[model samples]
Target chain A: MRIAVVVFPGSNCDHDAYHAFKHVLGVETVFVWHKEADLRGADAVVLPGGFSYGDYLRAGAIASRSPVMDEVSRFAGKGGPVIGICNGFQILCEAGLLPGALMRNRGLRFICRDVFLRCETSGTAFTSRLSNGDVIRLHVAHGEGNYFATPETIVRLEAEQRIVFRYCDPTGRLDPEWNFNGSLEAIAGVLNEGRNVLGMMPHPERMAEAILGGTDGIAVLGSLLDYLESLPLKGGKRGEVAREAAGAAQKGAEGTKGASGREAGGRCKAV
Target chain B: MEETMKAKVTVSPRRGVRDPQGRAVLGSLHALGFPEVVDVRVGRFIELIIEPKGEGGPDEVEARRRQEQRLDEMCRRLLANTLIEDYRFETEP
Candidate 1:
């Protein structure tokens, strides 16, 4: 399962994403430059975090109009799984691939810290490994992480079961105090209508390894790997092929654009 | 003949959308002796100078119309994100 991580100018987390997928998780990952128009036969695409175009106009705004985005949009259109992390999420929203817009944080501060998030749904590839009500911890750092949508869109998001994660206390109780960014509904992540595109203000790549203080990211990223490996014709081998392909992918890393996945946040519940 | 038109575009959060930045500015305003300021809305201001292509006098009216139309299109396509903000612009020769 070859994955393409698109990089735009000023993206800072591209290497982190590359390490998580290629080195830690042993997945075949590639770096796709933002100036390029193709995904190069990659199965899924990742829009990593960072200040693309220096977050000009708006976070992820300029990068959304990059050449690679058209290809990413087309890929998502064909049912390929796409994940936008942090600024990546902002890009997805700006590109109209996902609903809602991320505005300045409620308190008007650039918050950087570890937060808890409760799994709101188990239907998406990003959260399939986790169960409803499960809580995971990831890092979040941004000045504009507050998520907003029109009332109608918010209602639709709830009715359609597209919300993937929400902030909560350690015991999984929802509360306003825990909604650090003041995101509407205390939302931390959401899925598109197709259930293929996921945009979250948190960085899962930053926490994929246990040495980094936790392995909760496995439930998210690993679930994606699980989904990919389970594919009959599209995905092949877990025993040996995955390892060799991953090694080859690391060697081919020089060929594209990149950005980092911003820190992630998840609400906590009773384990 | 070549003529230049000056334009200004304004983009702001729609009513009912939260305005944390505006609120922050309002708080500061109130602190600075502007108690009468009960409401504040932060917005972006952009200026543009347009040089309409094609010959000028014969198609002046048509050129102006197309210039305005393109300005509107630019706002819709890039300058403003209608999902959350409202945008309007005016041009002058």
Candidate 2:
């Protein structure tokens, strides 16, 4: 499969992602600069982790406005698969491709360590290879990875099964300490309404090989490839209905907040 | 008569950082008998005042604009991270 990894100023993980795809997955990969507007015949795109724009303003805020993001948005709109890791996830949120926003760690500390993530939904192309509740270990390194969203949005995401992963223990038990950044509901990742776009705080690329302690991440990447291979040669009609539904849900939640004195719940669960 | 120009710039996390200061403040508030504090984040404020360079001349506006622009740039490049910090400025004469 052809893959494109977008590179922006201060993006340090682009090369790492390239290696994962090129060496481990044996896929044809290309580096697309953030200024480039074209995907150059790529079937899927990966926004690698790193401190884009030096994590200035917000981890992914500046990079979201980069020129290449227009193309990325269009590609996602066309139903192309996109996976954003770490800061890339931040950018996706900043670009509005994903719901919610990444906030500072609740502990006000930068966390860098191996984290456990429980698979929430295996129905999507990103997690089809894994079983629901499957636990995978990956590295999470960031200061601002906490995810926040209004209550209605969280409810809709849960109802739609859009949440993909949650911070948990190796035994797949929800543990607060396993939550690296205190993400709402201990969410480590989520999928867009289309389910083709994914944003996660953990770095799967860092654990794609056995040498990295385990090969759990390979399954996640493999799932993407499997899904891409299953797609019809011609791109399918984009899914706008899901987006509309999500927007409506957000509005409903906002309206509820306006009328009631209740605060929004955590994206996953209240800690 | 001379006119003075003033500008106020406020800088904050593009996404508010988990603020230990705010948390501490919240803890103190809780100790003082308030427990509804959910989260807290801190931000900064900066203000600058300058004399009008010239009466409505391009040079004056350009220079002032450049100065303000420079300050904004400095906030992102040095004072704040373009990624996690945002800044806004207001000007008055």
Output the number of the lDDT-best candidate.
1
State the interface C-alpha RMSD of candidate 1. Answer: 0.7
Scored by TM-score, the top model is 1
DockQ of candidate 2 against the true complex: 0.17
In order, the Cα lDDT scores of the candidates are: 0.81, 0.76
True contacts kept of 1: 0.71
Per-residue lDDT over B1-93 for candidate 1, one digit per residue giving the tens place of the 0 to 100 score:
276779999999888888998899999999999999998999899999877676656876787788788999999888988887899998777
- Model 1, range A120-165, lDDT digits (tens) per residue? 8773567768899998999888999899998898887887677899
Best DockQ among the predictions, by candidate number: 1
TM-score of each: 0.88, 0.73
